[model samples]
Target: MAGIQDGMTVMVGGFLGTGTPEILIDALVEKGVKHLTVIANDGGLPASVTGTTDRGVAKLLSAGMIDHIIASHVGMNPIIGKGMNDGTLKCTLVPQGSLAEKIRAAGAGLGGVLTPTGVGTIIADGKETLTIEGKEYLLELPLHADYALCRASICDKFGNFSCYKATKNFNHVMAMAADTVILGAEKVVEIGEVDVDTFTTAGVYVNYIVGGEQPWQI
Candidate 1:
């Protein structure tokens, strides 16, 4: 949190608002950092759905903190659509599978990946293509961020992270795709309390931890 500055690339872990790290997000809002390029699963719930307190990435959008977002889905938030129309924001929509693979490639230190997900469609526009055995594939590059904001249902002092149920979606993959990862854990347990097999994200990837976040709310 100390090193966060305006105009950095940030990856947030969430599906809509369900698995988002509220504490860290709220802090970012209070920090008033702007010109952020965020990468997430989708645009989060709007104020209409979540009432006065915007949920997940929507909070940042509401605060006009995000300048560009690279996500697979943006239809859920009107702010994103309106911004896209008004030229106030930039949105890069990649196919979900291809997006995940790109992040994975960055984390794994790979150059790039070839995928047919966007072949023969508008998604293939202005992109490199390769023909392998008469089938076309787009060469999707890796995605990396300056900081990744992640949430975990449980985290040990050493930073092993585990999520509860569906909340586990993007947090695991996002943990490894950034230069620094900030973890917000609902509960912080003793080092031996959580079994290693239960960890969704290993401790090595986490650089910072904010413990004792309130439990999930509707």
Candidate 2:
């Protein structure tokens, strides 16, 4: 894949550190891609007590590569809070389900998603509200990205993918919502090797495939 430019909105598939593409993220860090707007489920885990960092979005955050983040949670990574407090980074918190639906809506070419998830809280502020029948719902805009970095436990030469356990968290939806989708696969195999029943994401949604470091090793 080509290098990522500054100011691009990127969706990184993960739930905390579970499904993040660590190898691809390492590549991004090595390439020094800056001014990125990252979208993920969580901010990622902080550096370990031994001073070695080996988890999710925190690696990008530690390198000062991301300019903004749109995620469901940010409490686990202290770097995120520090960056936000120092005004070096901007953060937007959306309800988890709402965030997922927003991305799905974008992929499906919907105008927006109407949900009551944020009805009477700060989440409703600055957003449109519509009353259907007798209940009110907030209009959450669709969310898309210039690129999506996702993890797959198994990827074919043609880019079809399947993940194990929790690794499937946001990878499937993110692959559909991005203009360019890159898959970091723990094991790359022939197209027919992956069982059709196990295929969670189709090759049509993928643009590139890279060998990935195992999540457990990270």
Query: For model 1, how does the per-residue alpha-carbon lDDT over 61-135 read when each residue is reduced to its tens digit?
Result: 989999999999988899999999999999999898998888888888998899999999999898899999999
Give the true-structure RMSD of model 2: 1.6
TM-score of 2: 0.95
What's the true lDDT of residue 12 in model 1?
92
Question: Model 2 residue 100 lDDT?
Answer: 96
Please give the range of 10 consecutive residues that has the lowest summed lDDT in model 2.
45-54
**Candidate 1 segments whose C-alpha is farther than 4 A from its true place:** none
| Backbone clashes, each candidate | 0, 0
| Model 2 lDDT tens row, 2-103 | 657999999999887788888888889888888999999988877752156747888888889899999999988878888989999999999999999999
The 10-residue segment of model 1 with minimum total lDDT is: 209-218
